[model samples]
Target: MSDDHENQYHYTPTLWIGILFLVLFSISGILHILEALYTRLWFLLPTVVLANIGEIIGWSGRVWSSQNVFANTPFLIQICSTIIAPTPLLAANFVILGEVIRRLGQKYSRLSAKAYTFVFLACDIIALIVQAAGGGVASSADTDGKDPSSGGHIMLGGIVFQLVAISVYMLLATEFVLRYLKDRPVRPALVAAVGPRTLDTRMRLMLFGLGLSTLAIFIRSIYRVVELADGWDGRVISTERYFDWLDGGMITLATFTVNIFHPGLLLGRGNRWFGKHIDASGTSSRSGTFAEDATVVEPKRDNGPGAKV
Candidate 1:
Protein backbone atom coordinates (compact mmCIF):
# COMPACT_ATOMS: atom_id res chain seq x y z
CA MET A 1 0.00 0.00 0.00
CA SER A 2 2.42 2.63 -1.15
CA ASP A 3 1.74 6.05 -2.63
CA ASP A 4 2.61 4.46 -5.97
CA HIS A 5 -0.29 2.01 -5.64
CA GLU A 6 -2.81 4.75 -4.81
CA ASN A 7 -1.41 6.87 -7.59
CA GLN A 8 -1.69 4.01 -10.04
CA TYR A 9 -5.48 4.31 -10.08
CA HIS A 10 -5.48 7.32 -12.39
CA TYR A 11 -8.06 7.76 -15.13
CA THR A 12 -8.58 10.08 -18.07
CA PRO A 13 -12.06 10.40 -19.51
CA THR A 14 -12.74 11.17 -23.15
CA LEU A 15 -14.11 14.67 -23.70
CA TRP A 16 -17.67 13.70 -24.64
CA ILE A 17 -18.56 11.91 -21.39
CA GLY A 18 -17.07 14.70 -19.34
CA ILE A 19 -18.91 17.36 -21.31
CA LEU A 20 -22.23 15.54 -21.19
CA PHE A 21 -22.05 15.04 -17.44
CA LEU A 22 -21.14 18.69 -17.01
CA VAL A 23 -24.21 19.78 -18.95
CA LEU A 24 -26.41 17.38 -17.03
CA PHE A 25 -25.10 18.81 -13.78
CA SER A 26 -25.67 22.36 -14.89
CA ILE A 27 -29.30 21.61 -15.69
CA SER A 28 -29.78 19.72 -12.47
CA GLY A 29 -28.35 22.67 -10.56
CA ILE A 30 -30.67 25.11 -12.30
CA LEU A 31 -33.75 23.03 -11.57
CA HIS A 32 -32.80 22.66 -7.94
CA ILE A 33 -32.20 26.40 -7.65
CA LEU A 34 -35.51 27.24 -9.32
CA GLU A 35 -37.36 24.89 -7.00
CA ALA A 36 -35.62 26.42 -4.03
CA LEU A 37 -36.65 29.94 -5.00
CA TYR A 38 -40.18 29.21 -6.14
CA THR A 39 -41.04 26.70 -3.43
CA ARG A 40 -38.71 27.90 -0.65
CA LEU A 41 -36.91 24.57 -0.32
CA TRP A 42 -33.52 26.23 -0.15
CA PHE A 43 -31.34 23.73 1.68
CA LEU A 44 -31.34 21.42 -1.33
CA LEU A 45 -30.13 23.83 -4.00
CA PRO A 46 -26.44 24.15 -3.10
CA THR A 47 -26.06 20.45 -2.47
CA VAL A 48 -27.15 19.78 -6.05
CA VAL A 49 -24.70 22.31 -7.46
CA LEU A 50 -21.84 21.31 -5.16
CA ALA A 51 -22.22 17.63 -5.94
CA ASN A 52 -22.00 18.32 -9.66
CA ILE A 53 -19.11 20.72 -9.17
CA GLY A 54 -17.22 18.10 -7.25
CA GLU A 55 -17.90 15.59 -10.02
CA ILE A 56 -16.71 17.98 -12.71
CA ILE A 57 -13.57 18.66 -10.74
CA GLY A 58 -13.02 14.94 -10.38
CA TRP A 59 -13.38 14.42 -14.12
CA SER A 60 -10.99 17.32 -14.76
CA GLY A 61 -8.59 15.73 -12.33
CA ARG A 62 -8.77 12.53 -14.32
CA VAL A 63 -7.95 14.44 -17.48
CA TRP A 64 -4.95 15.95 -15.72
CA SER A 65 -3.94 12.61 -14.28
CA SER A 66 -3.81 11.21 -17.76
CA GLN A 67 -0.99 13.68 -18.41
CA ASN A 68 0.83 12.72 -15.22
CA VAL A 69 -0.14 9.52 -13.46
CA PHE A 70 1.34 10.58 -10.16
CA ALA A 71 -0.37 14.00 -10.07
CA ASN A 72 -1.54 14.61 -6.51
CA THR A 73 -4.03 17.31 -7.40
CA PRO A 74 -6.14 15.12 -9.65
CA PHE A 75 -6.02 12.32 -7.14
CA LEU A 76 -7.24 14.71 -4.47
CA ILE A 77 -9.96 16.04 -6.74
CA GLN A 78 -11.22 12.62 -7.73
CA ILE A 79 -11.23 11.35 -4.16
CA CYS A 80 -13.09 14.42 -2.97
CA SER A 81 -15.60 13.95 -5.76
CA THR A 82 -16.19 10.39 -4.71
CA ILE A 83 -16.71 11.61 -1.19
CA ILE A 84 -19.37 14.14 -2.18
CA ALA A 85 -21.25 12.45 -5.03
CA PRO A 86 -23.92 10.78 -2.90
CA THR A 87 -25.23 13.97 -1.37
CA PRO A 88 -27.22 14.98 -4.43
CA LEU A 89 -28.65 11.51 -4.81
CA LEU A 90 -29.82 11.69 -1.24
CA ALA A 91 -31.34 15.11 -1.83
CA ALA A 92 -33.23 13.86 -4.86
CA ASN A 93 -34.49 10.96 -2.80
CA PHE A 94 -35.76 13.39 -0.20
CA VAL A 95 -37.74 15.42 -2.71
CA ILE A 96 -39.04 12.36 -4.55
CA LEU A 97 -40.25 10.57 -1.42
CA GLY A 98 -41.96 13.69 -0.17
CA GLU A 99 -43.86 14.16 -3.41
CA VAL A 100 -44.83 10.51 -3.53
CA ILE A 101 -46.13 10.69 0.01
CA ARG A 102 -48.15 13.78 -0.68
CA ARG A 103 -49.62 12.29 -3.84
CA LEU A 104 -50.47 8.96 -2.22
CA GLY A 105 -51.71 10.70 0.93
CA GLN A 106 -50.02 10.57 4.34
CA LYS A 107 -52.81 8.68 6.09
CA TYR A 108 -52.41 5.63 3.88
CA SER A 109 -48.70 5.27 4.57
CA ARG A 110 -47.39 3.14 7.42
CA LEU A 111 -44.56 5.55 8.23
CA SER A 112 -44.95 9.29 8.55
CA ALA A 113 -43.42 10.87 5.45
CA LYS A 114 -42.09 13.86 7.34
CA ALA A 115 -40.51 11.67 9.97
CA TYR A 116 -39.01 9.39 7.32
CA THR A 117 -37.58 12.41 5.50
CA PHE A 118 -35.98 13.77 8.65
CA VAL A 119 -34.44 10.47 9.68
CA PHE A 120 -33.13 9.52 6.23
CA LEU A 121 -31.74 13.00 5.59
CA ALA A 122 -30.08 13.08 8.98
CA CYS A 123 -28.40 9.77 8.25
CA ASP A 124 -27.40 10.97 4.81
CA ILE A 125 -25.77 14.07 6.32
CA ILE A 126 -23.86 12.03 8.87
CA ALA A 127 -22.65 9.70 6.13
CA LEU A 128 -21.46 12.60 4.01
CA ILE A 129 -19.53 14.15 6.88
CA VAL A 130 -17.94 10.87 7.83
CA GLN A 131 -16.91 10.07 4.25
CA ALA A 132 -15.55 13.56 3.72
CA ALA A 133 -13.53 13.39 6.89
CA GLY A 134 -12.24 9.91 6.09
CA GLY A 135 -11.25 10.93 2.57
CA GLY A 136 -9.26 13.83 4.02
CA VAL A 137 -7.51 11.68 6.57
CA ALA A 138 -6.73 8.84 4.18
CA SER A 139 -5.52 11.12 1.42
CA SER A 140 -3.25 12.93 3.87
CA ALA A 141 -1.66 9.74 5.16
CA ASP A 142 1.74 8.45 4.03
CA THR A 143 2.37 6.39 0.89
CA ASP A 144 2.02 3.17 2.88
CA GLY A 145 -1.76 3.69 2.76
CA LYS A 146 -1.96 3.28 6.47
CA ASP A 147 -4.10 5.50 8.67
CA PRO A 148 -4.37 3.23 11.69
CA SER A 149 -6.25 5.91 13.56
CA SER A 150 -9.67 6.53 11.97
CA GLY A 151 -9.72 6.57 8.19
CA GLY A 152 -10.61 2.97 7.41
CA HIS A 153 -13.21 2.54 10.11
CA ILE A 154 -14.74 5.91 9.50
CA MET A 155 -15.13 5.29 5.79
CA LEU A 156 -16.58 1.84 6.39
CA GLY A 157 -19.04 3.20 8.92
CA GLY A 158 -20.17 5.89 6.54
CA ILE A 159 -20.80 3.36 3.80
CA VAL A 160 -22.76 1.22 6.22
CA PHE A 161 -24.92 4.13 7.23
CA GLN A 162 -25.53 5.00 3.60
CA LEU A 163 -26.56 1.45 2.86
CA VAL A 164 -28.93 1.48 5.79
CA ALA A 165 -30.65 4.66 4.70
CA ILE A 166 -30.98 3.47 1.14
CA SER A 167 -32.43 0.18 2.32
CA VAL A 168 -35.09 1.91 4.33
CA TYR A 169 -36.07 4.00 1.31
CA MET A 170 -36.45 0.98 -0.91
CA LEU A 171 -38.50 -0.80 1.68
CA LEU A 172 -40.77 2.16 2.05
CA ALA A 173 -41.24 2.40 -1.69
CA THR A 174 -42.07 -1.27 -1.97
CA GLU A 175 -44.51 -1.03 0.88
CA PHE A 176 -46.15 1.93 -0.78
CA VAL A 177 -46.65 0.14 -4.08
CA LEU A 178 -47.98 -2.96 -2.39
CA ARG A 179 -50.50 -1.03 -0.36
CA TYR A 180 -51.64 0.92 -3.38
CA LEU A 181 -52.04 -2.17 -5.52
CA LYS A 182 -53.85 -4.07 -2.84
CA ASP A 183 -56.30 -1.32 -2.03
CA ARG A 184 -56.58 0.19 -5.49
CA PRO A 185 -59.76 2.15 -6.15
CA VAL A 186 -60.85 2.51 -9.73
CA ARG A 187 -61.71 6.05 -10.67
CA PRO A 188 -64.14 6.44 -13.57
CA ALA A 189 -62.25 9.56 -14.58
CA LEU A 190 -59.02 7.61 -15.07
CA VAL A 191 -60.81 4.94 -17.08
CA ALA A 192 -62.46 7.49 -19.32
CA ALA A 193 -59.15 9.11 -20.14
CA VAL A 194 -57.13 6.06 -21.16
CA GLY A 195 -59.41 3.05 -20.75
CA PRO A 196 -59.22 1.09 -17.53
CA ARG A 197 -56.56 -1.41 -18.58
CA THR A 198 -54.27 1.20 -20.11
CA LEU A 199 -54.56 3.41 -17.09
CA ASP A 200 -53.69 0.52 -14.80
CA THR A 201 -50.71 -0.36 -16.96
CA ARG A 202 -49.41 3.20 -16.80
CA MET A 203 -49.80 3.31 -13.05
CA ARG A 204 -47.88 0.05 -12.74
CA LEU A 205 -45.10 1.32 -14.95
CA MET A 206 -44.79 4.51 -12.98
CA LEU A 207 -44.61 2.66 -9.69
CA PHE A 208 -42.06 0.23 -11.09
CA GLY A 209 -39.83 3.02 -12.35
CA LEU A 210 -39.99 4.77 -9.01
CA GLY A 211 -39.15 1.53 -7.26
CA LEU A 212 -36.27 0.88 -9.65
CA SER A 213 -34.68 4.23 -8.90
CA THR A 214 -34.63 3.45 -5.20
CA LEU A 215 -33.07 0.08 -5.94
CA ALA A 216 -30.41 1.62 -8.15
CA ILE A 217 -29.32 3.92 -5.38
CA PHE A 218 -29.30 1.00 -2.99
CA ILE A 219 -27.07 -0.97 -5.37
CA ARG A 220 -24.65 1.95 -5.64
CA SER A 221 -24.38 2.22 -1.88
CA ILE A 222 -23.67 -1.49 -1.55
CA TYR A 223 -20.95 -1.30 -4.14
CA ARG A 224 -19.29 1.54 -2.27
CA VAL A 225 -19.30 -0.31 1.02
CA VAL A 226 -17.68 -3.32 -0.63
CA GLU A 227 -15.17 -1.07 -2.34
CA LEU A 228 -14.15 0.52 0.94
CA ALA A 229 -14.26 -2.53 3.18
CA ASP A 230 -10.73 -3.65 2.41
CA GLY A 231 -9.15 -0.40 3.53
CA TRP A 232 -7.25 0.23 0.27
CA ASP A 233 -5.28 -2.99 0.69
CA GLY A 234 -7.97 -5.29 -0.67
CA ARG A 235 -8.22 -5.96 -4.39
CA VAL A 236 -11.49 -4.11 -4.81
CA ILE A 237 -10.45 -1.17 -2.66
CA SER A 238 -7.15 -0.75 -4.50
CA THR A 239 -8.88 -0.88 -7.86
CA GLU A 240 -10.24 2.64 -7.74
CA ARG A 241 -10.45 2.76 -11.49
CA TYR A 242 -12.99 -0.05 -11.53
CA PHE A 243 -15.10 1.66 -8.92
CA ASP A 244 -15.17 4.74 -11.12
CA TRP A 245 -16.89 2.83 -13.89
CA LEU A 246 -19.14 0.55 -11.90
CA ASP A 247 -20.08 2.90 -9.11
CA GLY A 248 -19.76 6.33 -10.68
CA GLY A 249 -20.65 5.80 -14.30
CA MET A 250 -23.42 3.28 -13.76
CA ILE A 251 -25.08 5.16 -10.92
CA THR A 252 -25.08 8.40 -12.91
CA LEU A 253 -26.72 6.64 -15.81
CA ALA A 254 -29.28 5.13 -13.50
CA THR A 255 -30.23 8.47 -12.00
CA PHE A 256 -30.48 10.10 -15.40
CA THR A 257 -32.80 7.34 -16.54
CA VAL A 258 -34.90 7.72 -13.43
CA ASN A 259 -35.49 11.39 -14.17
CA ILE A 260 -36.24 10.70 -17.80
CA PHE A 261 -39.04 8.24 -17.02
CA HIS A 262 -40.26 10.02 -13.93
CA PRO A 263 -44.00 9.50 -13.44
CA GLY A 264 -44.75 13.00 -12.25
CA LEU A 265 -43.19 14.61 -15.29
CA LEU A 266 -43.92 12.16 -18.10
CA LEU A 267 -47.09 10.25 -17.29
CA GLY A 268 -49.61 13.09 -17.54
CA ARG A 269 -50.15 16.25 -19.53
CA GLY A 270 -50.75 18.48 -16.51
CA ASN A 271 -48.28 19.99 -14.10
CA ARG A 272 -46.97 17.52 -11.54
CA TRP A 273 -46.69 20.33 -9.03
CA PHE A 274 -50.44 20.67 -9.03
CA GLY A 275 -51.25 16.96 -9.21
CA LYS A 276 -52.33 16.66 -5.61
CA HIS A 277 -54.49 19.74 -5.97
CA ILE A 278 -56.45 18.24 -8.84
CA ASP A 279 -59.45 17.27 -6.75
CA ALA A 280 -59.75 20.65 -5.07
CA SER A 281 -62.60 22.83 -6.28
CA GLY A 282 -60.48 25.95 -6.59
CA THR A 283 -61.36 27.71 -9.87
CA SER A 284 -59.13 29.58 -12.24
CA SER A 285 -60.33 33.14 -12.72
CA ARG A 286 -59.48 33.27 -16.39
CA SER A 287 -60.79 29.88 -17.59
CA GLY A 288 -63.49 29.45 -14.92
CA THR A 289 -62.31 25.89 -14.59
CA PHE A 290 -61.69 23.96 -11.41
CA ALA A 291 -57.94 23.77 -10.92
CA GLU A 292 -57.81 19.98 -10.48
CA ASP A 293 -61.05 18.98 -12.10
CA ALA A 294 -59.81 18.54 -15.64
CA THR A 295 -60.55 15.07 -16.93
CA VAL A 296 -59.15 12.84 -19.63
CA VAL A 297 -61.64 11.38 -22.13
CA GLU A 298 -61.03 8.24 -24.12
CA PRO A 299 -62.14 7.44 -27.67
CA LYS A 300 -65.40 5.66 -28.32
CA ARG A 301 -65.38 2.06 -27.11
CA ASP A 302 -67.61 0.81 -29.98
CA ASN A 303 -67.28 0.90 -33.76
CA GLY A 304 -70.00 2.08 -36.22
CA PRO A 305 -71.57 -1.43 -35.99
CA GLY A 306 -72.05 -0.78 -32.27
CA ALA A 307 -70.78 -4.07 -30.89
CA LYS A 308 -71.67 -4.71 -27.27
CA VAL A 309 -71.25 -7.46 -24.73
Candidate 2:
Protein backbone atom coordinates (compact mmCIF):
# COMPACT_ATOMS: atom_id res chain seq x y z
CA MET A 1 0.00 0.00 0.00
CA SER A 2 1.08 3.59 -0.67
CA ASP A 3 2.23 5.54 2.38
CA ASP A 4 -0.89 7.72 2.30
CA HIS A 5 -3.15 4.74 1.76
CA GLU A 6 -1.55 2.86 4.63
CA ASN A 7 -1.83 5.92 6.86
CA GLN A 8 -5.37 6.84 5.88
CA TYR A 9 -7.77 4.75 7.93
CA HIS A 10 -5.46 2.52 9.96
CA TYR A 11 -3.49 5.48 11.30
CA THR A 12 -6.41 7.69 12.23
CA PRO A 13 -6.73 7.38 16.00
CA THR A 14 -9.38 9.73 17.38
CA LEU A 15 -7.84 12.91 18.77
CA TRP A 16 -10.39 13.55 21.50
CA ILE A 17 -10.36 9.99 22.76
CA GLY A 18 -6.59 10.09 22.91
CA ILE A 19 -6.69 13.32 24.88
CA LEU A 20 -9.33 11.92 27.20
CA PHE A 21 -7.29 8.83 27.94
CA LEU A 22 -4.17 10.90 28.46
CA VAL A 23 -5.93 13.09 31.02
CA LEU A 24 -7.49 10.10 32.77
CA PHE A 25 -4.24 8.21 33.08
CA SER A 26 -2.32 11.28 34.20
CA ILE A 27 -4.78 12.04 37.01
CA SER A 28 -4.95 8.42 38.09
CA GLY A 29 -1.17 7.98 38.08
CA ILE A 30 -0.64 10.97 40.31
CA LEU A 31 -3.32 9.80 42.70
CA HIS A 32 -1.80 6.32 42.95
CA ILE A 33 1.64 7.73 43.73
CA LEU A 34 0.19 9.96 46.42
CA GLU A 35 -1.78 7.09 47.93
CA ALA A 36 1.26 4.82 47.96
CA LEU A 37 3.26 7.45 49.79
CA TYR A 38 0.51 8.23 52.28
CA THR A 39 -0.28 4.59 53.04
CA ARG A 40 3.34 3.33 53.23
CA LEU A 41 2.41 0.40 51.03
CA TRP A 42 5.92 -0.13 49.72
CA PHE A 43 5.16 -3.56 48.31
CA LEU A 44 2.37 -2.19 46.14
CA LEU A 45 4.06 1.12 45.27
CA PRO A 46 6.30 0.02 42.43
CA THR A 47 3.76 -1.96 40.42
CA VAL A 48 0.89 0.50 40.82
CA VAL A 49 3.05 3.51 40.01
CA LEU A 50 4.80 1.84 37.09
CA ALA A 51 1.52 0.63 35.61
CA ASN A 52 0.03 4.11 35.82
CA ILE A 53 3.14 5.62 34.28
CA GLY A 54 2.85 3.16 31.43
CA GLU A 55 -0.76 4.18 30.90
CA ILE A 56 0.24 7.85 30.89
CA ILE A 57 3.02 7.32 28.37
CA GLY A 58 0.83 5.08 26.27
CA TRP A 59 -2.00 7.57 26.07
CA SER A 60 0.44 10.39 25.44
CA GLY A 61 1.72 8.38 22.50
CA ARG A 62 -1.84 7.97 21.27
CA VAL A 63 -2.35 11.69 21.48
CA TRP A 64 0.88 12.24 19.57
CA SER A 65 -0.21 9.70 16.94
CA SER A 66 -3.52 11.44 16.56
CA GLN A 67 -1.61 14.52 15.52
CA ASN A 68 0.82 12.77 13.18
CA VAL A 69 -0.38 9.28 12.35
CA PHE A 70 2.47 8.58 9.93
CA ALA A 71 5.16 9.15 12.54
CA ASN A 72 6.90 5.94 13.60
CA THR A 73 8.09 7.22 16.99
CA PRO A 74 4.61 7.93 18.35
CA PHE A 75 3.27 4.68 16.88
CA LEU A 76 5.98 2.60 18.51
CA ILE A 77 5.58 4.36 21.84
CA GLN A 78 1.85 3.76 21.84
CA ILE A 79 2.21 0.08 20.92
CA CYS A 80 4.89 -0.72 23.48
CA SER A 81 3.42 1.27 26.34
CA THR A 82 -0.17 0.15 25.88
CA ILE A 83 0.78 -3.53 25.54
CA ILE A 84 3.04 -3.54 28.60
CA ALA A 85 1.05 -1.21 30.87
CA PRO A 86 -1.49 -3.69 32.15
CA THR A 87 1.11 -6.37 32.93
CA PRO A 88 2.25 -4.66 36.12
CA LEU A 89 -1.33 -3.91 37.13
CA LEU A 90 -2.01 -7.60 36.74
CA ALA A 91 1.04 -8.26 38.89
CA ALA A 92 -0.40 -5.98 41.55
CA ASN A 93 -3.59 -7.98 41.44
CA PHE A 94 -1.66 -11.23 41.89
CA VAL A 95 0.31 -9.80 44.80
CA ILE A 96 -2.87 -8.71 46.59
CA LEU A 97 -4.32 -12.23 46.31
CA GLY A 98 -1.45 -13.50 48.41
CA GLU A 99 -2.29 -10.94 51.08
CA VAL A 100 -5.95 -11.92 50.91
CA ILE A 101 -5.11 -15.57 51.41
CA ARG A 102 -2.77 -14.65 54.24
CA ARG A 103 -5.45 -12.64 56.03
CA LEU A 104 -8.08 -15.35 55.61
CA GLY A 105 -5.72 -18.27 56.45
CA GLN A 106 -3.34 -20.30 54.32
CA LYS A 107 -5.33 -23.50 55.00
CA TYR A 108 -8.10 -22.03 52.84
CA SER A 109 -5.74 -21.73 49.85
CA ARG A 110 -4.47 -24.45 47.49
CA LEU A 111 -1.05 -22.77 47.34
CA SER A 112 0.73 -20.89 50.08
CA ALA A 113 0.04 -17.14 49.97
CA LYS A 114 3.65 -16.31 49.12
CA ALA A 115 3.59 -18.83 46.31
CA TYR A 116 0.48 -17.24 44.88
CA THR A 117 2.25 -13.87 44.66
CA PHE A 118 5.60 -15.01 43.25
CA VAL A 119 4.30 -17.59 40.80
CA PHE A 120 1.90 -15.25 39.06
CA LEU A 121 4.42 -12.39 39.26
CA ALA A 122 6.97 -14.54 37.45
CA CYS A 123 4.42 -15.31 34.77
CA ASP A 124 3.60 -11.62 34.47
CA ILE A 125 7.26 -10.69 34.07
CA ILE A 126 7.68 -13.26 31.35
CA ALA A 127 4.61 -11.96 29.58
CA LEU A 128 5.88 -8.38 29.83
CA ILE A 129 9.26 -9.33 28.40
CA VAL A 130 7.71 -11.27 25.54
CA GLN A 131 5.33 -8.48 24.63
CA ALA A 132 8.05 -5.82 24.83
CA ALA A 133 10.34 -7.87 22.64
CA GLY A 134 7.57 -8.40 20.15
CA GLY A 135 6.83 -4.67 20.04
CA GLY A 136 10.52 -3.98 19.46
CA VAL A 137 10.73 -6.49 16.64
CA ALA A 138 7.54 -5.20 15.07
CA SER A 139 8.76 -1.61 15.22
CA SER A 140 12.08 -2.56 13.64
CA ALA A 141 10.29 -4.42 10.86
CA ASP A 142 8.02 -1.50 10.17
CA THR A 143 10.96 0.92 10.09
CA ASP A 144 12.98 -1.36 7.76
CA GLY A 145 10.05 -1.79 5.36
CA LYS A 146 9.93 -5.54 6.01
CA ASP A 147 6.75 -7.56 6.46
CA PRO A 148 5.61 -7.21 10.13
CA SER A 149 4.04 -10.66 10.34
CA SER A 150 6.89 -12.17 12.34
CA GLY A 151 6.64 -9.44 14.94
CA GLY A 152 2.85 -9.63 14.97
CA HIS A 153 3.08 -13.38 15.56
CA ILE A 154 5.48 -12.82 18.41
CA MET A 155 3.14 -10.26 19.99
CA LEU A 156 0.28 -12.72 19.62
CA GLY A 157 2.33 -15.37 21.39
CA GLY A 158 2.89 -13.02 24.33
CA ILE A 159 -0.80 -12.13 24.48
CA VAL A 160 -1.75 -15.81 24.45
CA PHE A 161 0.69 -16.50 27.23
CA GLN A 162 -0.80 -13.70 29.30
CA LEU A 163 -4.30 -15.01 28.65
CA VAL A 164 -3.35 -18.48 29.87
CA ALA A 165 -1.70 -17.09 33.02
CA ILE A 166 -4.72 -14.92 33.78
CA SER A 167 -7.09 -17.85 33.21
CA VAL A 168 -5.16 -19.99 35.68
CA TYR A 169 -5.22 -17.17 38.23
CA MET A 170 -8.99 -16.79 37.83
CA LEU A 171 -9.44 -20.51 38.39
CA LEU A 172 -7.27 -20.40 41.47
CA ALA A 173 -9.22 -17.46 42.83
CA THR A 174 -12.50 -19.24 42.17
CA GLU A 175 -11.22 -22.34 43.92
CA PHE A 176 -10.25 -20.27 46.96
CA VAL A 177 -13.71 -18.73 47.01
CA LEU A 178 -15.31 -22.15 46.88
CA ARG A 179 -13.05 -23.44 49.60
CA TYR A 180 -13.83 -20.45 51.82
CA LEU A 181 -17.55 -21.02 51.39
CA LYS A 182 -17.32 -24.78 52.00
CA ASP A 183 -15.16 -24.31 55.10
CA ARG A 184 -17.10 -21.44 56.60
CA PRO A 185 -17.61 -23.03 59.96
CA VAL A 186 -14.65 -22.39 62.25
CA ARG A 187 -13.17 -25.14 64.37
CA PRO A 188 -14.14 -24.76 68.03
CA ALA A 189 -10.57 -24.63 69.31
CA LEU A 190 -9.51 -22.09 66.67
CA VAL A 191 -12.40 -19.81 67.55
CA ALA A 192 -11.65 -20.12 71.21
CA ALA A 193 -8.00 -19.25 70.71
CA VAL A 194 -8.35 -16.25 68.36
CA GLY A 195 -11.84 -15.12 69.28
CA PRO A 196 -14.46 -14.97 66.49
CA ARG A 197 -13.13 -13.83 63.11
CA THR A 198 -15.03 -12.35 60.24
CA LEU A 199 -14.37 -10.53 56.97
CA ASP A 200 -14.33 -6.81 57.64
CA THR A 201 -16.03 -4.24 55.42
CA ARG A 202 -12.66 -3.03 54.22
CA MET A 203 -11.55 -6.55 53.37
CA ARG A 204 -14.79 -7.20 51.53
CA LEU A 205 -14.32 -4.02 49.51
CA MET A 206 -10.75 -4.93 48.68
CA LEU A 207 -11.82 -8.33 47.41
CA PHE A 208 -14.66 -6.83 45.40
CA GLY A 209 -12.38 -4.21 43.83
CA LEU A 210 -9.80 -6.82 43.00
CA GLY A 211 -12.42 -8.98 41.30
CA LEU A 212 -13.76 -6.07 39.28
CA SER A 213 -10.29 -5.00 38.12
CA THR A 214 -9.42 -8.56 37.20
CA LEU A 215 -12.56 -8.89 35.11
CA ALA A 216 -11.80 -5.61 33.34
CA ILE A 217 -8.26 -6.66 32.52
CA PHE A 218 -9.51 -10.07 31.40
CA ILE A 219 -11.93 -8.48 28.97
CA ARG A 220 -9.19 -6.20 27.62
CA SER A 221 -6.85 -9.15 27.13
CA ILE A 222 -9.46 -11.10 25.20
CA TYR A 223 -10.04 -8.09 23.00
CA ARG A 224 -6.30 -7.82 22.25
CA VAL A 225 -6.17 -11.50 21.28
CA VAL A 226 -9.00 -11.00 18.81
CA GLU A 227 -7.59 -7.71 17.48
CA LEU A 228 -4.15 -9.12 16.80
CA ALA A 229 -5.32 -12.47 15.41
CA ASP A 230 -5.39 -11.08 11.86
CA GLY A 231 -2.02 -9.33 12.20
CA TRP A 232 -1.34 -5.60 11.65
CA ASP A 233 -3.72 -5.20 8.73
CA GLY A 234 -6.59 -7.02 10.39
CA ARG A 235 -10.07 -5.54 10.39
CA VAL A 236 -10.17 -5.23 14.15
CA ILE A 237 -6.69 -3.68 14.29
CA SER A 238 -7.77 -1.03 11.78
CA THR A 239 -10.95 -0.20 13.63
CA GLU A 240 -10.51 2.69 16.07
CA ARG A 241 -13.88 1.95 17.65
CA TYR A 242 -12.64 -1.36 19.02
CA PHE A 243 -9.50 0.34 20.30
CA ASP A 244 -11.58 2.97 22.01
CA TRP A 245 -13.92 0.56 23.74
CA LEU A 246 -11.70 -2.44 24.35
CA ASP A 247 -8.18 -1.07 24.69
CA GLY A 248 -8.58 2.45 26.06
CA GLY A 249 -11.96 2.23 27.78
CA MET A 250 -11.49 -1.10 29.53
CA ILE A 251 -7.96 -0.41 30.81
CA THR A 252 -8.80 3.13 31.93
CA LEU A 253 -11.74 1.74 33.87
CA ALA A 254 -9.59 -0.96 35.45
CA THR A 255 -6.97 1.55 36.57
CA PHE A 256 -9.59 3.86 38.02
CA THR A 257 -11.32 0.98 39.78
CA VAL A 258 -8.14 -0.02 41.57
CA ASN A 259 -7.38 3.61 42.41
CA ILE A 260 -10.80 4.26 43.92
CA PHE A 261 -10.67 1.03 45.95
CA HIS A 262 -6.94 0.99 46.52
CA PRO A 263 -5.43 -1.73 48.68
CA GLY A 264 -3.97 0.96 50.92
CA LEU A 265 -7.45 2.21 51.74
CA LEU A 266 -9.07 -1.21 52.06
CA LEU A 267 -6.28 -3.16 53.77
CA GLY A 268 -5.25 -0.22 55.99
CA ARG A 269 -1.77 1.03 56.84
CA GLY A 270 0.99 -1.54 57.57
CA ASN A 271 -1.28 -4.45 56.69
CA ARG A 272 0.11 -4.93 53.19
CA TRP A 273 3.65 -5.12 54.49
CA PHE A 274 2.95 -8.00 56.89
CA GLY A 275 1.28 -11.42 56.80
CA LYS A 276 -0.40 -13.59 59.38
CA HIS A 277 2.27 -15.94 60.72
CA ILE A 278 0.76 -19.13 62.10
CA ASP A 279 2.92 -21.59 63.95
CA ALA A 280 2.69 -25.40 64.20
CA SER A 281 0.62 -25.01 67.35
CA GLY A 282 -2.07 -23.18 65.25
CA THR A 283 -1.39 -19.93 67.07
CA SER A 284 -1.18 -16.79 64.91
CA SER A 285 1.55 -14.16 65.14
CA ARG A 286 0.37 -10.64 64.37
CA SER A 287 3.88 -9.24 64.70
CA GLY A 288 6.58 -9.46 61.96
CA THR A 289 7.09 -7.99 58.49
CA PHE A 290 6.90 -9.75 55.14
CA ALA A 291 10.70 -10.10 55.04
CA GLU A 292 10.74 -11.70 58.47
CA ASP A 293 7.89 -14.15 57.92
CA ALA A 294 5.61 -15.56 55.21
CA THR A 295 2.45 -14.70 57.15
CA VAL A 296 -0.09 -11.84 56.84
CA VAL A 297 -2.52 -10.84 59.56
CA GLU A 298 -5.99 -9.56 58.94
CA PRO A 299 -6.46 -5.91 59.83
CA LYS A 300 -7.95 -5.60 63.33
CA ARG A 301 -11.62 -4.79 63.36
CA ASP A 302 -14.44 -4.89 65.89
CA ASN A 303 -16.28 -8.20 65.56
CA GLY A 304 -20.00 -7.60 65.25
CA PRO A 305 -22.68 -10.27 65.56
CA GLY A 306 -22.82 -12.83 62.71
CA ALA A 307 -19.60 -11.61 61.09
CA LYS A 308 -17.46 -14.14 59.12
CA VAL A 309 -13.71 -13.68 59.13
User: What's model 2's lDDT at 27?
Assistant: 87
lDDT for model 2, please: 0.77
Instruction: Identify the runs in model 1 with alpha carbons over 4 angstroms from their true place.
Output: 1-44, 47-49, 142-149, 184-206, 262-309
Give model 2's TM-score versus the native structure: 0.85
lDDT of 1 by residue, 180-272 (tens): 444432332322222221224555566666666566667777777776675555677556456656666655654554445544443442333
TM-scores, all models, native as reference: 0.68, 0.85
Q: Which ten residues in a row have the lowest lDDT in candidate 2?
A: 185-194
Candidate 2 wrong stretches, greater than 4 Å: 1-5, 8-11, 184-198, 276-295, 298-309
Q: What is the lDDT of residue 75 in candidate 1?
A: 62
Native-structure RMSD, model 1? 7.7
Candidate with best TM-score: 2
Q: What is the C-alpha RMSD of each candidate to the true structure, in Å?
A: 7.7, 5.3
